[model samples]
Target: MTHPFGFNYGGKTHYFVFDSESGSLHNVDYVTFLCVKNRLSIPFEGGEAEDFRALEKEEIDEINAELDQLASQGVLDSPCTVTQKKKRTGEIKALCLHICHDCNLRCRYCFADEGTYRTADKAHMPVEVGLRAVDFLIANSGKRKSLEIDFFGGEPLMNMTTVKAVVEYARSLEASTGKTFSFTMTTNCLLLNEENRKWLNDNMYNVVLSIDGRREIHNAVRKTPSGADAFDVILNNALEFRKIRGDKSYYVRGTFTAKNLDFCNDVLYLNDCGFDQISMEPVVTDLPDLQIKKEHLPVIFKEYEKLAAAYIDRRKNKDTWFNFFHFMYDLEGGPCVVKRLTGCGSGCEYLAVTPRGDIYPCHQFAERKPYKMGNVLQGVSYDRNVSDVFAGNIVTNKPDCTDCPAKYYCSGGCVANNLNFAGDMNKPYDISCAMMRKRFELSLAIAAIEACEG
Candidate 1:
């Protein structure tokens, strides 16, 4: 099933466009490639590729010209040497700043507590450090153009001083660089109060509160330092904040553990609470959480499907839309990018700054010392081991996924997760593959039903 150029497509082939000059391979799906193919041809000039439709003659010519350029550089054979190049729109134009390492609540699933998680000696980042990070971002903003900075935490508000500094700094940077800047925070919401809410409102900051659904489910997993229920205060603050914002963009992030598999009621409950967006992520850790056993996963998947289907139907029928995941799923042309492909911009394009000034690929990879891409002070440096691990698993092919039909879509799964748990990043991402296949199939089914009805 090899395409004319050298792209061998079987079930396992996750399509990627390799820039031989940059040594970077981009993960693009086949559908997107087909769309790209229909849009472009060679021998054209002067216009952004993005503005041109795939079916337009001039756009087609421009695409062919780009392909010819690649071919001249020995990257492709001719204008039609490879499948259509994936469009890198950079839609998720945001950066997550791990501003604080000290958290007030201690969840058992806290990746920070994971033995692999590393931090700088200090638990807080100074205002100057944040300013420098903003500087770095502003300098690189030309490449990305529009970008947003997100304040992430052990509890970001724990050091409100730094948060304020970074926000102000980003604004100043934007003023000087002419780059648009926005702010968001992912927090436990335990420390939020009227004063903080006012500050957030003044700054137009979006807040994503971490709450695990209802009282019992939330209290069971999230707790205060004194082991008391933390939801009461969080809910109160969220209500207060909502009153101030008068918008539905504020979100509640719910994490699902094995224990809460039977918690579909919580989804309805969140909707009743006037929340428009709700995020659900499975509890993933270095060591497999027993709650996410093979048998339990199907149940979890079924629960997600039930909740998502109901939520979508409600939204379509002019019922209240309560689910954030559904909105994210529908907005993107397909399923969530993370759920579909291997490797993200986490390391290469995106870097996470810890409170102590150390940088890692992401929060999850921060815990793993080997995955630390570099430090802020020293600048960006790619570790060969890290690159090799990623290249072997994601950038290159593997024996298990080499011949599989779904390889292109899954991209052999998460390199960091597979490397950490299975001691091999090159192995097949069987778990994620199964999950994505179900999601893709479900989405297609829903689309078909809608088409028939219309």
Candidate 2:
């Protein structure tokens, strides 16, 4: 069906219609949207002229003409939405390796159960496991000439020896496989010493350094295993890494908790700390200490407003380089959205493998049972979550999404977030939905304002 989403700007209503089947976007006015939407309710072919009898004849004709144009562009809803076939591309392309199920820090809001998978003992992924994961990535990479594997963990740096060995081993297979590999590692920066930093600079394609903004806020949660200072060490490592490899190939990633809704300050904190690339995403958890409550939502919106203004000021000075801008405005077209049909490529195009060689759809599901797609040795075997999520069928297939206009844009939200908050992978929490809607609305407004003013 042609999904129509309505929003207001400059005291006028506008609609953004998307055809899920064709992956096309239609920009139209409120009247056109309503008329077409109304017309599509039945098997009617045109808007009723009697509805606009109050207007002058010429105005009625003008509106009718616009309605015709929208219909021609196929923004009008299909007469039979229920009977349409779903577009499914459950291709596997990317792989994430849980290099180790161990970490050094004891962060307050850690979601991975302190990286031990909620168990007492923590194990570092062996080099052979890494090598096998690399082989699995290449084997399942399909026709894609380049394959990517992310070294993830409680902290990947804890198993630096295995990481180094894997890189060399992956390279050794490139000649025979004819597939090039790109590597990324996410580290908490505790073990990011000068030696490790220099080696990673030359070997790794990209690095994700995780830290919270501002020292006090960071220290409240992220701390070393011995309960000592972690913020200072992480900051120093980031600075040193930037000096060697620069910020383009890396991002200083941070998270926002309920305590810090005014996260604009954190963005500025990172900018002032000589970081050109930074990403501060909202933490996804149900913990009261970290959750952004309904009351906190307004402040977070305001923070984005403050951040957008600062971003504009920076842009005027030729310093605007924000990451989420891509979400605000897309110069190129977006991917085919199939939320009514499936979730992300958890079991299909993406796989996250544990140290013991078991594979799940994504990193969040890496060692979790039932969500397990297959083991690295045996390859993918089907389960309901894997089939439903990886097949591109999810919450959009349900009422909460089907009734929401913004579903096309969000593509039914994250499975991990839903499972964490909503207790069902197929159901989405209203909190995340509202946050995304506001963010999308605000981003669109900011993009429009910048385009006009700049």
RMSD of each: 12.3, 5.6
Question: Who wins the TM-score comparison?
Answer: 2
Q: 145-236 in candidate 2: lDDT tens per residue?
A: 77788899888888888889988998999899898888898988888999999998998888988878899889987877888877888899
Tell me how far the alpha carbon of residue 213 in candidate 1 is from the true structure, in angstroms, after superposition: 0.4
User: What does the lDDT come to for candidate 2?
Assistant: 0.71
Question: Could you tell me every candidate's TM-score relative to the true structure?
Answer: 0.70, 0.80
Query: Which residue runs does candidate 1 get wrong by more than 4 Å?
Result: 1-94, 114-122, 140-142, 202-206, 286-290, 316-319, 326-343, 378-413, 426-429, 447-454
The sequence of per-residue lDDT tens digits that candidate 1 reaches over residues 1-454 is: 1121112212232333433222223344543344333433432234323544435666556656765665566654322222212213222345567777777886777767621144555367688777766765565444666777778878887889988988877777665667877788887888888888888778845778788788888888677778888888988888777777766357778877777786566777777787777776666553455246667767867776676566556656444765455234231254444333334545534556766566666666664666765555554343535434343344234667543333444456666666655677666445555655555444433443344333
Compared with the true structure, all predictions reach lDDT values of 0.59, 0.71
